[model samples]
Target: MKIYVMVDIEGISGVYCSEQVTPASGRFAEGRKYMTEDINACVAGLRDAGVDEIIVHDCHGGSYSLNWADVSPEADGYICGTIGDSRYVDIDDCDGLILLGYHAMAGTAGAVLEHTYSSKRIQNMYINDVLVGETAVDAAIAGEHGVPVIMVSGDDKLCAEAKRFLPDVVTAQVKKGLSTQGAVLLPPEKAHRLIHDKAMEAVKKLPLIKPYVIPAPITHKIELMERCQLPNAAGKPYMNVIDGRAYSVAADSVEEARMRSGG
Candidate 1:
């Protein structure tokens, strides 16, 4: 089976500061190591499950945070930022998707590093009135392609969010968010083990989990930091201004939503 893995940083174990998630921050290097370890564990587990091809997408800021030298070369993957296009889950040909090091939606209580797209610009995002983050958006894309999200690894809030939308999908929580900037983390080794084991479980039960589907005419509400940014943000067609800081868009499906968001 083919699997697509998307990796982010905020939800990795021991990441509780902005510095860890930013490229300019000194602590980002350490966060990269932690993120890499978690991904490696998941890859190992997927391999154990007899997955034939693994396509990893570095989904964090500008992507390219993980050390490519350390990753298994056998796995074909793409570093984030390399592609100028905004395609979140480019899993058109993959069978399953795996979300690694994801985080909670913006404004969520007790969620570590919680923020949708940008902490500076995005105030909140909703799909059909359901509060969602990157995970939810990407899962929708997977659903559009008839692919199931088999596993997700992140903090407790992120895991809980995933379970709320996808009850049967496997989740590995490496930390518990106390705030957007604070978290109680598990040791890297322990977190890695949990991710690996859970990934294995997810793959084994992949056939049992249903793809998350959204009804036709998908509606999205984006709450931006500045009202003036609305026109630019709504450059795509069919985007209507609901109010200051809020804009609405309609698409035929979730994948179309991603396209509208330039994801």
Candidate 2:
């Protein structure tokens, strides 16, 4: 009955401006508050759903985006700070994973704050030739460990992306993205309520959900935004430099491929 929750800031309700998610910006704290409340709503729902243990992870850049003090007391534990590449830590032991405040992949039309893993470095990412976002990446990691992603929350595009990647996943769409920095938002209270309801619904439907497995021998490909971002691995055995701005890594598992790619 344990569940893991991964929280990001870009897609939270009322968060539309890029400065709101930038740690150096004066508006960053406001975004953190919104993220914390959204997670609390999900936490409350999970608790009501009879989940025994809940763990929340700050998945945003630097992992300092969560207002931990404002998070629900019901959550059993929290993981924050520089967690490095071991993003799937302890996910194998959880019954389900929930993605909160996630957004769409890079180049997604009308997706708010749209970008893949790194907005500055990565222009695009694909697994088995299918373009994906953080949602699919996390889902594959969980799937590698036999954990199903049961719920996701974000803007309309993100929710739709979740459904396309993870079957039977329940989603809470808090806003409708009009552009990269703009969205038609739901009132905070309404968004939180929807999250609460969807969280419970996701857990309730868990029995019908399945792990989203991207078959073995995964080919992790990355398209860098700038040619200079490509690492100098001219003769590396593990990597195949596609071009000046692209590279590919091959591995038997999704996690291994991601780790090797430094994703």
Candidate 3:
């Protein structure tokens, strides 16, 4: 079986503060090590499960977040650079997709490092009137091609978010968020073991998990963090201004809506 793994930095094991996830911060190097090791743990589990192909996508921040030298050699391929371009992986043929190190969406109370696609510009996002984070959007994109999101790993809030949206998606909670930046964390050793075991469990439960499909003719709404962004959004041909800080776009595909609205 082929598996695609999508990674983000904020929810990575051993990561707790904003500085650790920020590339410019001196503490970010420590977070990078944690990110790579967590990915390796997942890769090891998938390899042991007899998966033939494992593709890892560095979906966090311009795709330059991963520690390339430390990534497991067992992984078949690595996707890097700016996301949503030609370099993005084609998940159409993958049997399952794993969302690793993802956080809850913006406005999620008690979610560590919570934010949707953009922390600075975006305040909230919704699809078909349901609030969603990156997890749902990415899963919906994969679902369009019939691939199910089998597993997710992060803090308790993120795990809860995954379970609420995907239902059957296996989740590994490595930390418990007390606030946006504070969390009761698990040691790296324990976190890795959890991720490793969860990867195997997710693969085993693949038959019962279904792709997260959003209804067609989807309406995507974006609420900006500030009203200043409204003028810029109103000029976009694809955008329909809902109010001073919000805009909506109608599209048949999630990808199109995201691309058109710059979500």
TM-score of 2: 0.98
**How would the candidate models be sorted by TM-score, starting from the highest?**
2, 3, 1
State residue 134's C-alpha deviation in candidate 3, in Å: 1.0
Residue pairs whose backbone atoms clash in candidate 2: none
Q: What tens digits encode model 2's per-residue C-alpha lDDT throughout 1-263? A: 99999989998988998999999999999999999999999999999999999999988998888887788999999899987678856787899999999999999899999998789999899999999899999899898899999999888999899888885899899999999999999988999999999999999999889998999889999999888888766666778999999999988988998888975
All candidates' lDDT scores?
A: 0.82, 0.90, 0.89
Which lDDT tens digits does candidate 3 get at residues 20-83? 9898999989988999999999999998878899999998887888899989999999998865
Clashes of each: 3, 0, 0
- Candidate 3 error regions (>4 Å): 83-88, 231-237
Best by TM-score: 2
Candidate 2: misplaced stretches above 4 Å? none
Clashes by residue pair, model 1: 86-263, 87-263, 88-263
lDDT: worst 10-residue window of model 2: 83-92
lDDT of 1 at 111: 94
Candidate 3, residue 201: how far the Cα is off, in Å: 0.6
* Candidate 3 TM-score versus the reference: 0.96
lDDT agreement of model 1 with the native: 0.82
